[model samples]
Target: METDKQQKDKQQLYTDKFFESGHWLLKIRQVLIATIGWLAVIIPIVITVLAFWASFDPRVPHLWAYHEGIYEIKFIGIILIFAWVMTLIFAVSMTIIQNRKRDRIVEQWPTFNPINQKERKKTIDDFIDKRFGPKEFRENVRSYTVKPEQNLETHQIQELYAKKDLDDVD
Candidate 1:
């Protein structure tokens, strides 16, 4: 019979192999998607900041000559600001849509739902145990009985007083 440690080692090896097998492309795709998503959110903000800075800075050259006391730089800055706002709205909407799609997929396919799978649940439990150590439950020594007529605090106080009296007698 295999010892517990040996069994755990075997399971770990199996898990490592399972993750390594034929999933590198999927992992790369996930990383690329995450990077693109972050860039989509960040690029607009950076452009907006640069546009605002250019609009105020005297040293920066304007895109065109100022016409009728109206700075063309301000117009360009306003356009950039609008573009940034639209980009933010698009990113937020896409994130919400992606989340809803993922949820729908998980709901439709029970196999994709980890909570519904016993093996996945066991794997999660094992990971938790390994990461945080096994949960230690201590026995409850103080037991209290509360009647229907009395409140919980009164019952607990009465129990405490009785225990004190017993301690004094002893």
Candidate 2:
């Protein structure tokens, strides 16, 4: 049956694409992690350097890890730089991609059928006919006669009062 197929499709759709914590927030979190991943590398490198020099030289007057060899510092720097570059690239690219997606969603947004004068009149008439039966419907209901310049606030209150009056008459 179609219902069975639809249920199967629903189950498969979850496996096809993972939506976690809303799409935009997930994108934002990805960028944050990527950017902070670099910080994770850089901050430790800096701390290690500071701690190293402070350990040997009392004059340095700081608690810092200093790796003495130039190669070691260069290695850490290289590692930090790599982390920064990878995440920086990911962050910017993900932002642009998510922005495009956001725009697409906005562009494809659905519209609602607005309440208009004709529809409003029909809705009122039909509702009255249903509630009051034919004879009372004919006697009590009148065409909406608000001026075009009237604000929606008064129009809504007028509609509510009209419904209440009809109810009381019934």
In lDDT terms, how accurate is model 1?
A: 0.61
Question: Which residue segments of model 1 deviate by more than 4 Å?
Answer: 1-22, 58-158, 165-170
Instruction: Give the Cα-based TM-score of candidate 2 against the true structure.
Output: 0.29
Model 2 per-residue lDDT tens digits across residues 1-170: 57877877775434312255557866777789999999999997787666666666778757534445645766788999999999999999999999998888856753322334455556666655554456564577785454565435646545654664432222
Clashing pairs for model 2 are 48-65, 50-64, 50-65, 51-64, 51-65, 52-64, 52-65, 52-66
Stretches > 4 Å off in candidate 2: 1-68, 111-170
CA error at residue 139 for candidate 1, angstroms? 12
| lDDT (Cα atoms) of all candidates against the true structure | 0.61, 0.65
Candidate achieving the largest TM-score: 1
After best superposition, candidate 2 residue 35: deviation in angstroms? 30
TM-score to native of every candidate shown: 0.31, 0.29
